[model samples]
Target chain A: MTSKSSRREFLTRSVQGVALTATGGLVWSYLLQQQAHAAPHAIRPPGAYDEAGFNAKCIKCGQCVRDCPYDTLKLAPTGEMVAIGTPYFIPREIPCYMCEDIPCVKACPTGALDHSLEKIEESRMGLAVIDIENCLSWIGLRCEICHRVCPILDKAITIEHHPRKLSKHARFVPLVHSDACTGCGVCEKACPTEIAAIRVVQPELVQGKIGEHYRLGWKIDTPITQEFKAPKRKDGKDTPATGLDYLNQGEI
Target chain B: MAVDNNTVKPDTVKLGPNGKPVRPFVMPSTLVGKLKVWRYIIYRRIVQLGSLLLFLGTVHWGWSIAGEPLLIGNLSSSTLFGIVPLADPFAVLQIFLTQHLLEQEVVIGAGIVLLIYTLLGGRVWCSWACPINMVSDLASWLRRKLSIKDSFILSRNIRYVVLALSLILSVITGIAAFEWVSPISMLHRELIFGIGMGWMAILGIFIFDLLVLRDGWCGHLCPLGAFYGVVGKVAPIRILFDTPTCTHCSECVRVCPEPKVLNFKKAAEVGMIASGDCTNCGRCITVCPENTLAFGLRVQSNISKKSSNKLESNLRRAT
Candidate 1:
């Protein structure tokens, strides 16, 4: 009976495998087309921001999860030894707002998240690009909300004015200046659309890299003041200094 | 020959005066019968059940409002709740070596208690008080209804492999995943964590045990069983049988819950009682009409064999 059942199972699996292979060929072509055109969606930065160091270094103590003020971080269930207690943020639901202070960086007890840089410019939380076709502002509506509310301001978000033909009453369109966007995703939240017309996109920037493009303006080194004095002789006599002949100061 | 109280002198007895040894001092007739049903109580199954009920009562009445009122409170996170101070040596060893449990000293301390008990008593914790063991024993009882008998060859050794993997992973990752293997986790997780794949995995193991193995997962391939077995060797306490009066009726062997590997008939030559598998249920003692059983502590080396003899003599005396 067991051998018969085994034979039946083998036959069933073989038939299913053949069917799946036939279906898989057609599905792959459609998937390729989708991949070619699919725009990158909003995603958290790839690396575990708080645990970038070597594996021997980590203890997986759930310290980062406890310290996170947003409570967005959670320890993965046990047995997932690879990525346990390393803090990760889910962006579409709870994207990093790119706070000027970057509280998570400060909260990390270990040097997992680098603590040296204080300014927002020093932070490299991936860049944000706007979806022009889906963006509400691009539809000739008055939506410079991203520009006005952008935390990084001109460096993180800017608007390009273009001629508007879609809106009956409008004459201009708001274009998202992608380079200026920090991908904080506030614009995604601000868009008063059912489907969130504007979205933050991925593969932009990561932490640890210096932002040479937008260096903080207040950090240049200042020159120190200097005092000038004439040299004195051991005999305590006033030495007469000359260009080629220092007559009184030679013996001392 | 000397004349004793109520006995006639043997050699000097005249025609009808040869005393019949005072009727051989026949013991009171009332004392010779099967022991009462209460003899079974010494096995302590009642004690285990009573404590289990009391624990359930306390948790039901108080745990919700008080929240994790026991050792390692609200171990709602792990695979198996490493409570029950007996099987915790492995857990504590991990903690001290890994430095992951320095802050949770109470839980580590509880693990130490289990280690100490293991050193002192041979797997008594598994037989008497471990909730998982109790559940497994209950599952064994239910095995009859399911028409399932455990055959080690047929059952999967996934739990042991998983246990080894979990230990290796804990060594590597500093997280013991034993809580995930627990049966209670399956029931509790739905209410606690909204029933994800983690709970489902535990449920799958339990279903497999109930349907296939019937004695649940622990009876066959628990690595924890291996862990307890190591500690059981040094356990001074054991259930010894008197070989002279054993009758080889195989009564004890028949009622034994552990496999034949742990049976006293197979194990006695090595001076072992049964093994870590012996639950001390006393089923063997209850069924024996010969009354050749009694529990006693080991004494002098000369008295080791004599102790079994003494136990049987006492049983016969009492009868």
Candidate 2:
């Protein structure tokens, strides 16, 4: 109220206001660039959409964070590495429990989480990967903690028998199948390593795609064998027996 | 509110050596009269705190009816009875600006909220529903009680520019720009769901409002309030200025949070406070000793011809 409200002064303030707004907005955008990019791999709750879809659709209401009974999910606040206000979990600290009811997804007002994911087993929140170097089973120690704790059991994580050098024993290595693993982080939490040997991460980080055109000829499902069948001899008869066969017949 | 600047009852005001009213706005004799003075404030508190209670109760304590959680989300987006959806329209608009179309439920929810505020007056959300209002109100109240002088001057129009910038930045940033950084959202969301570094930002707002300027955030810097102001333009509910009863005591102007909206010449030209900036908080109505202001339908605010003519002549003479 102390300032004069002359016409020229009003225009000057208008220009100043615009300049301030633009400068402030740019600063805010810079913060967004630093903060809102959804961290390296903040594992989401079950039924979350693809990262891009989830980022766009999530209203940041924290309903999913609120409804998670196990408190596995947290709304990323100002200081977290995840996109600010989006629901994410640190698997090593508190992994998704893979609740049968999928309460968190149900609580999402928007379908940032896929509502159609009725069974929690089907929700690929992330992919669990093993660090072979640190894994107890890989080191020939008897630690199958990850395999034992996986909710999907033998289907999601099965043990592979690998023969050890100069020993009659075999190392039972736990294998995580992308097809069945829900990435619930149970295995990550249960691992007995100093730091978790098995960890959940966004699938794209480790998973490789067998391109659509590639074919495994050895697999029964692929029919490359038929295409590679050699043409029949022009004579339509078998070739003469080799020298070994002829000698064997002559009793040499 | 400044006690000296509040409404002066004709009999209650003491005359000073110069015969000017001093120590205006004395307390009433009866408890009911005192309650009448704070009726709107009490209702506002109930609405604001009641909303928070609903969210807190539902989230923390399993408050439900017929197996349905009540008001699951915070103010950004929520569902009533797990059926009727509600969302902040401005947030939705920012998301929309990001080129991401929301689900029909949220889109409809935004529409429902917009329609309600459009009818009730947009900043009604600010006074009646926003939790930040309580903080801002406390700041202003303490300022008046403690006689805190504003450290700086700011334009009320800055909020509109901020609103525009938020939308533009949303497009550029590929996210809800304001929603990401908004202290309003941070405070309510963190309070309802969980605690984080959110309170630090809200604390900044409180200090900024309390010490730097009176009604600084709500009146001058909140893009959400500005968005609602634009949405609630031509709102059916408005503060009708009764020209005949007004004594030109200037109390309403002093008490008004958005005092510029109560322009006397403009209100005289039109029989109502026509600015979308009027929050319909009814502070002016409550403080008017002469009953000069009241809520009325905007369409029906055409004053009686005699009063209109008188106000027009007064306006001319004053000019």
The best candidate in terms of TM-score: 2
Q: Tens-digit lDDT track for model 1 on A135-217?
A: 66676667767667666676566666564356454434444554555556666666667766666654333224564344354
How far does residue A105 in candidate 1 sit from its true spot (Å)? 18
Among the numbered candidates, top DockQ falls to: 2
DockQ scores for all predicted structures: 0.04, 0.44
Indicate the residue-level lDDT of B281 in model 2.
86
Considering every candidate listed, which one attains the maximal lDDT? 2
User: Which 10-residue window of candidate 2 chain B scores lowest in summed lDDT?
Assistant: B15-24
Task: Report the lDDT tens digits of candidate 2 across residue range B165-258.
Answer: 8889988878788888888888888888778888888888899988999999999989999998986786898888876555556667777889
What are the RMSDs of all candidates, in order? 17.9, 9.4
Q: How many residue pairs clash in each candidate?
A: 10, 0
Query: Global lDDT of each model?
Result: 0.45, 0.82
Clashing pairs in 2: none
TM-score per model over all chains: 0.45, 0.84
Per-prediction share of native contacts kept: 0.01, 0.59
